[model samples]
Target: MVDKPKFNTALHEKDGVNQPESFSASSIANITKLRRKQPTATELVQGILNGNKTALSRAITLVESTNPSHLEKATNVINQCLPHANKSVRIGITGVPGVGKSTFIEAFGKHLTGTGRKVAVLAVDPSSSMSHGSILGDKTRMEELVKDENAYIRPSASGDTLGGVARKTREAIILCEACGFDTIIIETVGVGQSETAVHSMVDFFLLLKIAGAGDELQGIKRGIMEMADLIVINKADGDNIKKAKLAKTEFNRALHLFPAKNSGWQPKVTTCSAINHDGIADVWQIVSEYFEMAKGNHYFNAKRAEQNSYWLTETINEQLKSSFYTREGIAPLLEQYKKAVQNNELSPFAAAQFLLEKYFSK
Candidate 1:
């Protein structure tokens, strides 16, 4: 052998330490400095497509970031990635706690992976951050699916968005698609009401239900039930098998009470045991059928186009609101105007006019 460096150096030897693997104080400083420089939008998009998970994560952070400095960069990143996005089928899954939403996703994701599809699970556990919230960990529940190379699990707190789905999840889905994931699943905590956020973004929306819940109708409102492309009865094995079947029948009947979600496809309700992996294939079949029908009718492309328009309008409205609120002296004027209105010194209309006049004066 050629003369080799000493192979017996101590683990803590600074000189012998691998530079890239170093977790030293200086390493963190270097990372901070690198982040501060902030890669260009094109470079960021390229890194995301090249499968740099860190870059992808950081890109999403930039999207969700509230910082004014990151906003322009985030917009550029989205614009750059838009052409490479919207190729994947986006699915939204929501259910009350104990309905095994994560467990079902795990089983379903494994089924998709078995078929050579790259699956990405973006679980939004809105209840995770609360002071007294129960079931704070959706990721922990998805243990088996988490280990698969073909699957990506990103468990995000719902944050200020109440539907257990991140406001930025739409952006996250685009990032996932650009990273080569074919199927993107968004899981939400079901608080009964319809999750307009989840419904608006996904091509297919699924609702999960459990058996023997006396307040079955109470748990899911009509508006949400009306939006479901499919309803799955999870935990269908063991003692609840019969109950699960019954629940499916009930849902099917209830589904008929509401009009069909789309002209070509009627929502179907199925049962599954995610723990035992029972009926998981059937669930996938139903989802595939829905996709086929939707795609065949050309509604798939149309829907995405409509969603894009919605996103643009919504983004513009938000930006306008932010600009108005943060317009230099607007806040102080509004404060003074609020006191004026309270004392009947000015009407709400007049106060608004005053603010508008001051805003446009500059």
Candidate 2:
């Protein structure tokens, strides 16, 4: 028999009894000392430009924060990074629930990273009422991509946003692009108007659908289908392969009925098994071809310019609403108006005009 080595352990005395020591004040102090100070906006911008993941994450957090003080710093960071942005390809992926979005993203991200492309996935998850945070964690689902050195995954909470995207997602994209991520994937919450919001921000919108479900066409809105630049029937392996093919054919026929897109690019439908990594490259190839065609026709730059103008107007409207609603007197007045409207004592238009008058007078 071989002799076993004995390892020394620190002991602590409790009630005249010896126990293995778990923690020490000195160790806690050392940990506190080792914690890094928060980087300034300028430092974050410089660090992100240098491809530092930690700095990029910190900058995103700053942008996501609702804190009034952090807003200026976040704006500064985005402005500094704006010149470096727009160099990467932005793709939006959306689907109904249980459509294997995480699995698809993991495989898709791996494929891009394998080709030496730095990929960043911004996954918007449904928010919780209790915590007001994202509940569907993407990190655990995307195990492979989570471990990939070239891949970055962020799960954002769809906090009261009907479109299933975080308010600061656009700013986050700029930071990712500044950090040299060549491929950016925005995964929507897959409910309500989220698909439209994602479509506005991304260059390519890919809608993932499953086959064999009787309600396939019924569940997806026709508007979403029209927005899709490419439709993919995921989970096509084994028994599902035949069904997936049929669904693809059905979608192809349906797409032809819609009028041609302004970009002059025809939408394509295909099938793939995200779990088995089948047709992943074909999806990327299609995306590449779309980019090539859009750029050739100068539609890519034109679309982005339009999107910028849209966001500018959107930001102003949001800020105006926020400023008005958050005034000290607004809440009480709103409660009073709510009762009056419910009792049919005051018309909604009159109440709204009254509130606006009161707000401006103050």
Candidate 3:
């Protein structure tokens, strides 16, 4: 038999010309990725509807992008996904730093997924002042939940203001909901106005606190306390149980002082030791009761509608403010006006009005 030359694709060249298959695997992958076109908004929306986490993440990244070019695509994706959203129960969880927010969320999320619920956690991490990037080191705390097939943990940087991070997060919530997460938990950075912003966006606002953190009744953040639908005292295991019980009682009394919530459901307080998975079910029970009552009273849908309106206005305000400052000729004029105001050469309000008029004149 005549010997036929074996073709070694990696070793053989096309008449002294190299083909893509001749390149190393890593190089081929890199080149292929570079050559691939980005997915269309419709494609992303379809992927999200089909429960694709990767596509959901890419869409979220697009939503969070600062590039003006991405805004149009992001808006399109959000609009398409909106019809599939508003189905999940949004739970906002917040507390002061070191209050075991991450740990508690990890436990709570696992419990939820065990019940056959898909959980999406928008864990807003405090941004580094110098680098202004996500400090996701704490993501390790949710090691178990991170590996859970039904749970999605997204750690985002809390930008300079709640407007930036919260806005992107609100969009992310819609995407997660469309991607089949039945339970959406937004964990705030645990400081500043982030809690209030989160409270507005979620169906149930949960305030997680540690025992003996202060008066527990009045020393807490009053604004957020008023917004909370439930208060959970975490880390109640071992020697902390007694203190957690006392804090729970104090918080219950504190809730009584605030007028009944518009949801017509009285806020409840409970204690949990997240490390041991203690009392975790009780917390979910309280949340379930709240949902049951809200849905029965038809308040749930009404509240979401109100929130939608609020966010619409909020987005407009943020964009208008951004547009004003980012407009051409506004930066130099703003700087001059700022220096003038600092030197007492001009009134702040007058300068602001002039800047607005200048911006509008364009």
Q: Against the true structure, whose TM-score is highest?
A: 2
C-alpha TM-scores of all predictions:
0.82, 0.90, 0.88
Q: How close to the true structure is residue 151 of candidate 3, measured as C-alpha lDDT?
A: 92
How many collisions per candidate?
0, 1, 0
Prediction 1 TM-score vs. true: 0.82
Predictions in order: lDDT: 0.82, 0.90, 0.86
* Number of the predicted model whose lDDT against the real structure is largest: 2
lDDT of 2: 0.90
For model 1, which pairs clash? none
Across 105-193, the per-residue lDDT of candidate 1 in tens digits comes to 99899999999998988887654454634444656887888888888888766765656667688888989888888999998867764
Any idea what lDDT model 3 has?
Answer: 0.86
What's the residue-level lDDT of 139 in candidate 3?
A: 62
Write one digit per residue (lDDT tens) for candidate 2, span 1-362.
99998665567433666776899989989888866567788999999999999999999999999777888999999999999999999999998889999999999999999999999999999887688866758999998899999999989888987779888898899999999998999999886564667788999999999999874676344788889999999999999999988888888888898889999999999889999999999999999999999999999999999999988988898778877988888999999999999999999999999999999888
Error of 1 at 80 (Å): 1.5
Q: Where is model 1 more than 4 Å wrong at Cα? A: 1-37, 127-136, 219-221, 334-362
Show where candidate 3 strays beyond 4 Å. Answer: 1-36, 163-165, 192-194, 215-221
- In model 2, the Cα lDDT at residue 217 comes to 70
Sort by TM-score, top down from the best: 2, 3, 1
Candidate 3 C-alpha lDDT tens digits along 1-362: 99998868886766765556655989888989975879999999999999998999899999989887899999999999999998899998887778888889999999999999999999888776788777675568899999999999888777776622445899999999999999999888876453557877899988888887674745354687888888888899888899988888878777788877778898888889999999999999989998999999999999999999999998999899878877888999999999999999999999999999999999
